[model samples]
Target: MNVAFFLIPKKDIVYLKEKSTMRQALERMEYHSYSAVPLIDNDGKYVGTITEGDLLWKLKNTPGLTFHNTEDIHLSEVEQHVQNLPVTIDAQIEDLISRAVVQNFVPVVDDQQTFIGIVRRREMIEYCSQLLLQRKVE
Candidate 1:
């Protein structure tokens, strides 16, 4: 199946800007109940990803700093250490699933490489479950 069949539309994505604070990112992550979120620039270009682990590491490693005081810390600063893999909108569903297996979620981009949305592991699993159920019904 084409990725478009399972693509999480841009509107449904939870994303943050590069200039945002780690605290802001964390808040969004918590409020949305996501383990990770796609990072975007002011121009809406897909830059990378930030995970809960990344936030925890930052809190643990940053001496004498608190999450409350992270307002001064830019998202870009944290994203520098994040693992971001490239993914295209036209990619097949199987390839997207493979990438998600290793990355948790894969960022989708347009032809210009602009950040569009994410294909999350949970969504992939749900899609697979639906496919399996459909086959079983048949």
Candidate 2:
């Protein structure tokens, strides 16, 4: 029941660096077709999650801030609406499922708190569905 079993490795995930520009975050999110993405620090630790809402809010509140000129805004400066917090690598599936209840993916990190991968809600649903079906069959 290790969470790693459900992990979508970091290599396949589009994540934002703490120092990346708001423009970079937007481009990466658009490229990956994701509404939210995990933000990692320079040391590879999970900082927080950045969502489309966070971006829009920043635009609406910040003076003179527009999509056309996001180069001056750093990702770190944009207030993040953090979703599911990260789970350690050794965390169980039960823990993953609980967190996925609130977010699309549960960010997984190592003992050092370094970003590793994510367990998507789709995977959690499939696992629970299979479990439920097995009970019905029994």
- Give the best candidate by TM-score: 2
Quote each prediction's TM-score: 0.85, 0.95
Q: Give a tens-digit lDDT track for model 1, residues 1-138.
A: 776766777788788888999889888988999888888888889888888887787888889879779887887877345576867888888788778777877888888989877777788899899999999999
Cα lDDT listed for each candidate: 0.81, 0.90
Task: List candidate 2 segments past 4 Å from native.
Answer: none
Query: What TM-score does candidate 1 reach?
Result: 0.85
Residue 81, model 1, lDDT: 59
- Residue pairs in clash, model 2: none
Model 2, span 8-110: residue lDDT tens? 9999988888798888888888888999999999999999899988999999999998888887888899997666699998999989888887899999999
**What TM value does model 2 have?**
0.95
